[model samples]
Target: MQGRVIYQEHIDVLIAGGGVGGAAAAAALSQLGLRILIIEPGPAQGRRLAGELIHPPGIDGLCRLGLLSDRSMPGSPVKGFAIFPADKDDPASSVTLRYGEKPGTRHLGRAIEHRILKDHLLETVQRFPGVTAWIGARVTRIEENPDGSFTAMVRSNDGEEIRIRPRLFLGADGPMSRVRKLIGISHETRRYSGMMGIEVEDTHLPNNGYGNIFLNSAGVAYAYAIGGGRARVMFEVLKGADSKESIKTHLGLFPPLFRLDIERVLATSKPLAAANFCIVPNASVRGNAALVGDARGCCHPLTASGITAAVKDALILRDALSESNLDIATALRRYSRRCGRLELTRRTLAEELREAFLAQTPEALLLRECIFSYWRTSDKACVRSMALLSTVDTSIFSLATQYGTVALQAFRLLPRWFFEKTVVDWHRGVLRLVHKSLAFQYAAIRQWLY
Candidate 1:
């Protein structure tokens, strides 16, 4: 399957995938006066159902890279998140966590449609003096040179083969990254659930300017405006659950105010679906090649941190390279080490939140209650939780502290359950909770020290 190379070129960096991460990387690295080439297998205008929501830190990163601005950005401003607990009878009980309410945090996030955001980033990067982007082109083969440089064989949409040699290679292709595989970096993927998304027009959220999350026994539903009066509603479809039935059940869980609008959209348009999975890679950097965005790793979308993490990855990579004086090896090592810790915290928080929100076990249910109670009663708790959720703070120590606090609060409520259950059953649940808490603390400590 050796294809004749029709064109050959060299660049300082070759980035595979022209989506959010790749585009941002090119934009950031271009400032270093490095020649960059980006190859995207998808269309110039992508219509994929992917991460659209960006946390504040993500917005900050894009702004820092000059990829986003108030005049140029195309998206709705999200003040924060409003969460509706499962089976709640009253909408007033929903808790609203607003950004900037916590001191020293950014004021808002953004929720642009995935396609629009990707196009904007790609276009922005292409205008840079040293950045070139190829639409409908992909890297088909990669070979390492004796000097640790890379030669990649790219195939354009029309079958034109191009050869590129670059000092550094970045894989921002995605979770199922061919670059990662070709580079011999193995990863483990765990399917958590599935998501179905439908766009409804001319509808308004109950808490306007805030992302709304509805939690139910079936799973979680997210509703928010994407921009220009269009709202996106996404529902989680647990494994083995019928997609049609899950959509219906989740729609019913929404407030009556906009359920009709969602139903109308659902009837007229086909939904977009994506798998919810977590991927942990054995390594994010190998030789002269490195992985960013989901190519490095991904977590469950329950925390809505995909785009946020992707943007952060680019900024971190930029800083590493700049700090290491453009030494690819040293820069990559630094990026890998720092991002490794952040990924650990991101994945751990997402997993914990998923279980607390969806798991039906006694311990999870109690933990959920404690979480809600903590948010409602303590302003500082909400601030801390939102900081972690927004990736403004990725400290393992803070995570452990937050979890320990909630576990203690849960323990305080165990006395009420003592009378409702047999002593043995109640004791068993408490023991399980304690064990889990202790295990998490130990892991956090170990990760912190290492």
Candidate 2:
């Protein structure tokens, strides 16, 4: 197809997606006297409902970005998370996790829609003098120009088309980013298969302040308290059958041990259904185009750090752009530098956790159980684990190293099997870290885009 923009527009920065990352980027850039244009493809038909668990920093990011300015919306202020690990049936079931009432943490999921947050961000963009927001527009092709700029060809629902040329392009587009692919940036797409999440609420949970995970032979369920006498129940359904039907057929299968949460879930499952997912984990940026949120990399939604990670990407990129020489390429390079040096180790850790958890092997289940036990017992370990999820520090590796050492030490206090299992998981984790570290170094030294 010949690339032609039916209408032409100019913007200092063209952001391809207006979710958390793109919206935050536009808001930040708008403050700097830049004309910003945002293109967001609205929710797809039968859109995936985000059973996303938001952290404190995510809530902060929304307020900071002006997306959740309404303090009264019970739907937007999460103060904590409650997690149940392993089979809730085992009165002594291990691998149950919780994160509330911690020293520095506050609030959990605000029971809000990601779409609402995205729309609010677009609204924030409109407040900027030179910002223009376009919903229902999907950028299909991107033409990278030789003058350090690019043109994106986007199509709207009404079949109208437009071309946007911007000095800088930010592809907050998403996990399946067309611009990132057009820029020749490939992602190691990891299908987080064999898992499903269902939203159900009936009564106040064990503790809404913390997120819960149920690690059983069937699969893992990460229960997040969504506030207001409700929580979202996410678990693995039987693989390869119609998952929703499977959930419906098996709704009464929750073991006798978790009768409270189970009964409530069964009581309130009237509007609940299963949402399947996939995630990207390889690269976060490419030349002028960058990815964030589920866009850059999505690990197990069990982590539920989507909002935090996306918002943080925009924040650091904002800083990277500000501190650098203002050269678009250089600034983007710095941004990539910041992300990799800043996030790779922890990201690798998360990826390793996924690999270990996917198979539901005895070792994986045991270790998951042990991790839940450790985190619940130690405040420091809780903080360390929480920090890794937040990805707020550049030295997450150091923090993880210290915590892993501690974890290993504590694990040694247990059976030898647990230690060996952790070590095995690290084999994959460390290799990923090394690979990402090298990738970042190469990008820094060579500036190779293609």
Model 1, span 159-236: residue lDDT tens? 887777778899999999999998788999999889989888636467878888998877889998998989888999
Residue pairs clashing, model 1: none
lDDT of 2 by residue, 197-253 (tens): 444453534444556555443555655554455556655664565665545433433
Off-target runs (Cα >4 Å) in candidate 1 are 1-9, 44-46, 101-105, 147-149, 422-426
lDDT of each: 0.84, 0.59
Q: Which ranges in model 2 have alpha carbons more than 4 Å from their true place?
A: 1-9, 43-47, 73-81, 87-89, 92-111, 194-198, 227-230, 238-283, 355-366, 393-396, 399-403, 406-450
